[model samples]
Target: MKTLMKRLRAFALSGIIGVGLLGSFPALAAKTTLTVGAAATDVGTLDPHYATSTSDRTLVAWIYGALVRFAPGSTDPSTIEPDLAESWQVSNDKLIWTFKLRTGVQWQAGYGEVTADDVVYSLEKSRDPKRSAFSADFAAINKVEALGPHTVRITLSRRVPNLLGLVTNYAGGFIICKKAYEERKDRFGRAPVGFGPFQTQSIVAGQAVTLIANDKYFRGVPKIKTINYRFMSNNAARDLAFAAGELDASAGLANKSWLQRTTSIPGAVVDVFYPAELTLLHINITKPPFNDIRVREALAYAISTQKIAEYRGERFTRAPKSVIPSNNLGYTDNAGVFPYDPAKAKALLAQAGYAKGLTFTMLSSQLPEYETTAQLLQGQLEESGINVQLQPVEHTSWHQMIRKDLSPVVIYGAARFPVADIFLTQFYHSSSIVGTPGAVTNFSHCNVADKQIDEARTEADPAKQVALWQEAQRLIIQNVCAIPLTETSQVWVHNKKLNWGFDLKGSMSLGPLVTEQTSFSD
Candidate 1:
């Protein structure tokens, strides 16, 4: 009781003192340093063209500005605004997109003006499959031709209704400086240059990335002077650091217990947001037992999404209706495929020639969230006579094994929203088979949802197009390619005095971290 009062008094006194000194010692009264602790050791790449991992995206946002950007710190796709391109127009047929670039956008590190050539070159590189993991995003563009120094035209083979959404920083929307790239080549990945509100002061691979505010930022310069992003992979350690004031913010964990405990700290503020993340389990259809549709349906019936969401903590979790999460564009409620009915599960199992029930090994990551959820699922499956042997493996090795088609079941958690076609094609199209043709993330190795996906992409009318996407989602659910367990919320704990520049709606990248608009109140 005394400790709490003491801490509370200290905050009050600090605020009072800060306010009193502001007029006389304004510079000394302002707080300048902002530190963000992330739960990652390394980024996949620093090059904006190929940086796709969470860590990479978070840091890259500081350096790059996409042609179009999602409204800062917002998950709402409707709030997209112009970046390098001041305006854009699409042809009546929607196959051609013309952009009017903004004038006088300066590049970092002595690079010259950002021009049509740079925009076209950056997008073309993003379109090359060999160079970019996100090439699939830019694959629809037939050609990117520069009309002039300040104008660019893009020709698409067919209509892309969601192409505008894909250009955001989270997607393949970041523009690059061609001159800087040709001069640096592969070295550009380590030392990137861009025109954003902040620029990299220094970066040490796998350790920390330091950024200084861009004084000449097109948008106003950030009130905070420096942002130090530290890599702390351990959840407990990261949380402890935030609680002790070593960190101003953290990557925000999914676990609820941590949130409950951390929010109790004096002057700490915790915000939870549904950041388009879905926790799902993938059933390999090519595997012997799952090859039978009845077996897949039986397994689905056996696992209870309600129970799974409950086990994951209902406060931060919601039961997912299908493989396509509710946050995505084509979301529809066809939740009837696998309602929790053990009797129906057993009957289907018997019909599939497994009268005594079936047993399979499910490979899960060694991370606490994955391991604990797997164990909880194991208990839930027993209720339906579906025996599952949960094997915990290293996170990296687990992903490799699942992609290799080794596990009978693989648990995956990802979110592709606003542009639902990504989930539809990458996880459902047969050509997207992980180790095959496209070398995509499609571990299901099935193509039942391809037709609907293709139709949705080219559909001219927005309403009818949505129906096509809904049909594709229904197909994935009915076919039992994967089982969605829950929509997990990511949580961020921060100091109360830290003004994050924007209200916490949700972030597609960094969860409630400081931005150019962010500053300290005291």
Candidate 2:
């Protein structure tokens, strides 16, 4: 009996030792799997053309290819290196552009070779009034035609120097499978087919999305076979999952507490990329009380952007004085429009006939940074004798409320682009406000109309177009349609064991993510 008991103890101890060894190196014990967490509140349509939100663009980029891609170090936003297209040139007149497509690129759906016809078909579908997916962006294109199987020609209605930049934009320009669209036009947006480095394996909306390597990708198959995107409604949960070893990387690590907690763990790193977007308070100028320019100017001076930046720490940049940041192509230092003056704010309020002080609610979502900024602005405005209320709502509800023209003031952020043209055209252009959220422009409804903004749309000269855009910015700031607060940096948290390289300007292109530039350490 003693000998039998000894044998049983030995067996139990061996099993325990084996388990301990396995626990010591989790990476070695299992298949290499990477899980990324994102705080995506809404499920977007899969069709790249129809995707409107930034979160949806993040997913679409992985599934599609653009004709030209922005080179990593290129300072010119308008200059793009070839992707699906091997080479491209513009006519001396700068109105017509021709592209030579690469040979032997296959769509994911086993469709025949991607031809110029596919490019023409994709652009036409995007421009269809019935589609309404990305019509505003492509409205300037007069026509797109297939010169041949390998050559595609695009003619613009006007001289658009930044046409290539527009083509690289994630939402509207992704190449789709012509055959797949013809057969599944109704559901194509739900399940898109593209020729990208990564192919969609499966997606469970608002839960997780899985992507597998595209073996037949033209650039080359991605080294990583699988990429799993897990959705978390907020940063707190995402940070917890990363610390617990369930997630490898996450975006929107804006919370300081979460960053502090995660960085404390071994093998974890925090990367602070340049401000991809800016957060600001938007006032509805189309409505009453706010219609008065004095009231708008008063509100701009009443809030302290510096305080908001200080509270947020290094993650936030000081609110830019101009609508476009200095880093943008046509950014000009225009401080005259935005000056921090409490007394001036008070006087403006009185001038606007609110000597007793104006009271209004500031709407924001559950984002901690936004909520904190709103609270700080509330305090600052109160100090300036303006009564302000901070109204916090769910993200989805907030989006809905803003679209209905119900919110007087709301806190919002928009991702930056290479050119100021994209900013002015999308947000301030009259046509853009019709169907979109208008958050980029914040539906500020400024009266300082610009025919130049319209003329620049068809204008193709780079220098001339930039001059027009600068004028638009000048007008926008002069009118004080929306208060520019701060340019907020994109904070990404990841395990140091994984390697990834992303541009300072956040790009929807997945080349950086797929090229093994982003990898994991053993």
Residue-wise C-alpha lDDT for candidate 1, range 1-522, written one tens digit per residue: 999999999999999998888888635558788898876665556787666456677778777887887777677788888888899999888888999999888887768788999988889988776666567666588999999999989999887757777677664678777888888888888778888777778878768888888776677777888989898877888888988899988776556577678878899888777565777777778888999989998878887788777656666787888777677776777744478888888999999898887888888776556777788788877877888988877564565577677777777777654567877776787757777736456777767888888888888778888888888877887889888877887667789989887778776664553567888896
**Candidate 2, residue 192: how far the Cα is off, in Å:** 2.2
Q: For candidate 2, what is the total of clashing residue pairs? A: 8
Residue-level lDDT for 194 in candidate 1:
82
lDDT tens per residue, model 2, 1-522: 999999999999999998889867645533345688766664456787766554566677777887877654233465468888998999987889999999999898577688898899988877775664556667778999999999999998776547786666355677788889889988776677888867777778668888777778887766566888887867678777888889887765455566667679888877665434666566777777888889989988887777766656655455566776666776666635577889999999999899999998766776555666677778888988888877777665665566555677767776545567666665566655533532324366554535767766666566887777778887777777778777766666777777554443445431124432345666
CA deviation > 4 Å runs, candidate 1: 1-29, 182-187, 203-206, 350-363, 366-368, 382-408
Model 2 misplaced regions, further than 4 Å: 1-32, 72-79, 128-133, 255-258, 361-363, 367-372, 385-393, 396-404, 435-442, 447-449, 455-467, 501-518
Against the unseen true structure, what C-alpha lDDT does each candidate score?
0.77, 0.70
Assess candidate 1 and give its TM-score to the true structure. Answer: 0.87
Error of 1 at 485 (Å): 1.0
Give me the displacement of residue 131 in model 2, in angstroms: 2.6
TM-score of each: 0.87, 0.86
